[model samples]
Target: MIDPIVMIVTMLIVGQIAVSVPILFAKANKSALNLPLAIFLVAIGALALNPIIASMAPNWYALYTALAFPALFMLCPSLWFYVEGLTADTKWQLQKKQAWHFILVAPALIISVMILMLPKETHTAIFIDDTEVSGWFVSLILVSMLIMMLLWLSQCVYTLIKIVRRLSHYRKRLKDLFSNNENKELKWINWLLFIAVCTWIISLITVFSSSLLDQFLFNGTTEALFSLILIWSLIHFGMQQQPALVTDEISPKVKNELIETLDNNKNEQSKASKTALPTKKYQRSALSKEQSKRIADKINTVMQSEHLYLDASLSLHKLAQHLDISPNYISQTLNQTLTTNFFDFVNQWRIEAAKPKILANEATILDIALDVGFNARSSFYKAFKQVTGQTPSDFRKAHQT
Candidate 1:
């Protein structure tokens, strides 16, 4: 029988690796936060730590200096990848320099190990650990890990902050481009990064704090952190693999873009609009271009006139009645020409409209969301994110910048 604790930890590591494979193989949105690469590196690095430790064999204590030394460098790759993915609106790219972030730090990492291997007589003792390991050496390793961890955490925090700053800009752009006000806080963008930060902080607290420990504290902290890693794996790793899409909330413009893109004669994929492939099937419609446009124009008028999007219950059926068109026609026109369904198309405008209101800072996100026609803050939030890509709090942060 497998030891539950060890097996669980092993599975957590495996899940992290498995989660990103689909994203790497499937058609993923180019502008996405590169979950595949980040998770891949993190999974490998996390798993590699133990093996590297095992390699320290025979030398035993000497292995900490050798194997544990390079672990710091290993850790940096996943973090940098995640941050770059989060911050960039376009698909992420690693600059040549970025490609070498780990490499550049390697020399220091090796030096730290060598310092750890130095005779205790060579340096003053700081704290006593088992064996004759000098305080200076252990302190150096601990300090290095602490510094790197802080650096990683800081970058992750700053990237999300930058994304939040773009919220106001999204509002201004959407208002002029599409006159709707439903999305307030771009939910996806904020929530994912927010969760990432929270999870990372928890990991940091667990992992780094373990460095200060001796045998007793190390055992408890490692187990606790491993437990957290297990829990986090169940959640975040699962999410990364599936890449939950707010398809219903996606705007017609984006959907239209996708449809047009898929049908286009271009042999090579254009980087024009970052998009993932659509595996979901859609039916072909009999509606003509002229008929679809006419229908859309009428709906647009009603949308602006009654501000229908603010009504959270609004749907193609409800709006079709107002347009004096059949629901089939409404859906057909929306699918064929607009490239998105009625729900998302209208809600996109609503979210766009909600941006400015969120910016006013007078209304809370929940209040502004309702004022704009959302039934619940979560729905408003989901739509807002599906369309614009920021959260209400971040949206507020963007305009202030």
Candidate 2:
């Protein structure tokens, strides 16, 4: 009979899997993180079902077990892919170069095939008595399992290191590109990576410390719990986040082109600034005071007249396009001329737009927050306090009476 705990876990896994797969593929689920996450849930669900299958069908258990090992190796790579999807500026897709990451699985696959090749009587005999297994075969299996665990541990460590480096670089670049880094920071992806690292650590420990049967059951139960937590958090945090329109670190060719353009602009600016005073108050950048004022004026005029901040999906690339300027140039102008960033610069206008509505008592605070492009009332409240030194409610209260 299947273990009672295993059976209960299996039911939970099945129900969640059934609900999750459809939602993952639904039309509303557009994030690149969705596919890898769906695959992760399916892999965990298959693992969860293993105990039930073994109890119900003894003859096919070896095959089931063999097929499942590859998915175990896939978890970290899926997570890495999800992070890449969030961080990469260009479209994220699995490429041929990344195939090398899976080379660590070849030994496990070969060993699994070897297990599958065993005669039915041999499989049954090995299941019943340890002494029936050949020493060489047992050694091969042990060595392969050891190698697989090492690969898992190494992959987890490598991924965590990459995530740290990538997030650091990403955030630094966001500071350059966006005034408000709150939405573009991709903090949820970091949480996912940290949780995955913990799960791998647990698996690594269970592998060495437990007997074969104990390892299977203990690892399965523990990993199932982890999987449930991961899936729940992944969906909850992930589904709400829209991928950034542009991330840091685009192609070298494009970066070089942007550098060339900026350099050209600077040469022209120097000639123009030759007669102008060197110490205008807002003229901190190498760009001429004239050009900085021109761009800043254009930015404000467009923002005031077009109300682009109301779009909620507005981004640096989109704003640059609206002004017919390069994104780098827009960022530089904002940083140097206004001493602000894109996120703050835009949301400042949003907060400005929201104030009149709040003072007029024309609508609910939540409705006004949503109308002014904030996705959440809490986010609006935070930005409002940051800008006005008062919450929306407090500001409204003081102004109304």
lDDT of 1 by residue, 1-401 (tens): 32345555655555655665565535335534454354444544454344334333324434344444455455435544543453332335556676555653566566556666666544223212334444665667657666765665565555456556555443332222222334333344455455555545665555556656522324333543454454455345434432211223445555443334223212222323213432222224455668878988887787778787776666544565577675556655555555664556877778877888888899788898778877778777777877768878876887896
Q: What are the models' TM-scores? A: 0.42, 0.67
| Residue range with the least summed lDDT across 10 consecutive positions in model 1 | 265-274
Which parts of model 2 have CA positions greater than 4 angstroms off? 11-42, 114-136, 161-225, 232-243, 246-289, 301-311, 352-364, 388-401
Deviating ranges (above 4 Å) for candidate 1: 1-7, 18-36, 39-89, 97-104, 112-401
Best by lDDT: 2
Error of 2 at 389 (Å): 5.6
What lDDT tens digits, residue by residue, belong to model 2 across residues 1-401? 65576577677767777787678767325455677767766676666667777788787777886787777777767667766766664556667898877776687688789778776766666643334566677667757777887777788778778878867765655544443456778887777766766776676677656655454535566765775666667767765665553433555654543444333233223323534544232344456657877999999999999998898667666687678776666766775567666778888999999999999987998999889888778778889999999998899888875
Q: What is the C-alpha RMSD of each candidate to the true structure, in Å?
A: 13.5, 7.6
Number of residue pairs clashing in candidate 1, backbone atoms closer than 3 angstroms, sequence gap of 3 or more or interchain: 17
